[model samples]
Target: MKKIEYGMDFVARNLGIFKCPVCGRSFEKIVHKSVSCDQGHLFDFSKKGTLYFLKHGVKSDYNDETMWQARRNVLQAGLFQPIVDEISSFLSENRSLRIIDAGCGEGSTLKYFENKRESNKDIYVGFDISKRAINLATQGEGSAFFCIADLAQLPFAANSFDAIIDMFSPSAYGEFERILKKGGILFKVIPNENYLIELRHMLYEKNDNHYSYSNAEVLSLFKQHYPQARVKRINYEFTLKETSFEDLLYMTPLHWGAAETKIDDALATGLAKITVDVLLLMVEND
Candidate 1:
């Protein structure tokens, strides 16, 4: 556990009808007002306190609690501290910022940021498609608000967030642009070529094909929608303990190809070090 910030209380208390999902306008209050934009596109808030603005739907495979628990254990072991530190550094100066982890898994990253910057008191919101993950996140004593929702169609009004994070998860650029406040930053983390070479080598007995993308390519894509954006890169290496071998396998999307027998063998083989390459981009909504 981490200490909850008092500034979170301020954001929660002043919470009202947020951004306009269609036009990206900020509204002071939302009431009998059927949320409509200048283009006549309309949205409605659900009774459960979430607004539905997405037209199409997206699905996810991380619906299992077992997988989330395994991922949490590995993350909590400090294997991904570098990435956490990078995220925290970007958020250190802000006070009472409205932050959302769009694809927050098991809430470890969100919790870590909240714990590290206890004085900032930012309102941390974690959203995932998996109900199990959100449920587990809420159980932890923190200032985080957990929601079960899809990123393709975010539940918040347009320009509602001060900052939004999408770490190694599917991102909806349109949805991100809609939710982020003007001049607000959206930080996205994507894995580099050698993110988990050790685990891939042990499980496949060969090199796993990594998803490679150039910073320019990603920047071009964001620039198409948002012309003013900057990209930052963070790279690090971490040593994995024997105890975390199984957890690492289970938590990764690579687990489908990993056999139980192979995992057990790796656990017995002892600790290994792996490199992590992450791309963090700060995109301003145009």
Candidate 2:
């Protein structure tokens, strides 16, 4: 077995009361016998030593295990290391933090952070609509609480997390605002226009008009929703090995449209360099 890092140990130590189910207030300690808020909403800690605060309806298809395993493989290969590096740099100032990764697919990004950082004082929580993803994450060395919950309606209470990560996933502005602590940072990463161009080229046999919203458009959207937040953009390029190329195609949303012949052509063609444009928005919870 591989050794688990200190970050994993940190998450396990701060297990309870860090997140309030009703209001999303993150507490340094659990003072009460039962976890409750002033609103009288109570949540119980599970036998597995995790919490399930989400009570509303949730989606089901994401609970499949196979999809999560594939996602984990793609991420673990370091194909998307630039994005991970940016996430780490963004949170460097934060020590002993309570971090949550919303729509945390296979938990690779969260695990990467846990393994890279030195502190065992921070708690990392990964929540997704998929129970399979959560199960796989829990099995790993990193300490993360997984939940099958909706992004639009998070199970956590307001202002609970010191930081929240939204990477290539759906966003719930209200829920984000509710769960992030005051002055908390929310890092939202979206793909740039050139992301996965090789796969796009192969699938279409020609470049179709790639659909990408401008940075200005993203800025406008964030301004409208989170006026007080500060935002930053990080863009870079990475060389891809044959396996990385295949992983890129397989893991992206573009895989559905790729023809078998096109995939074969890409495999035969060998190595390629792809540009990665990611927008990292560091928003403050106002």
Best lDDT among the predictions, by candidate number: 1
Off by over 4 Å in 1: 1-60, 92-94, 205-228, 241-243, 259-261
Tens digits of per-residue lDDT for model 1, 79-149: 77787787767664747788889888788888888888888888777878776676666556676766556
Residue pairs clashing, model 2: 23-157, 23-158, 24-157, 24-158, 26-160, 158-178, 159-178
Per-model TM-score on C-alpha atoms: 0.75, 0.75
- Model 2, position 178, has a per-residue lDDT of 75
Report RMSD (Å) for each prediction in the order shown: 5.8, 5.1
Off by over 4 Å in 2: 1-67, 92-94, 205-219, 241-243
Model 2 C-alpha lDDT per residue in residues 1-286, reported as the tens digit of each score: 2223232233335444245455655433332333445455665444343445566655666665655676677678676677778777767454578889998887888888788774745777887776567667766666666555667767665566888988988788888887788878888887666666555666664444433334567667877887766656666666665345656656665655557786688777745776677677777675
Relative to the true structure, how large is the alpha-carbon lDDT of every model?
Answer: 0.67, 0.66
Error of 2 at 181 (Å): 0.8
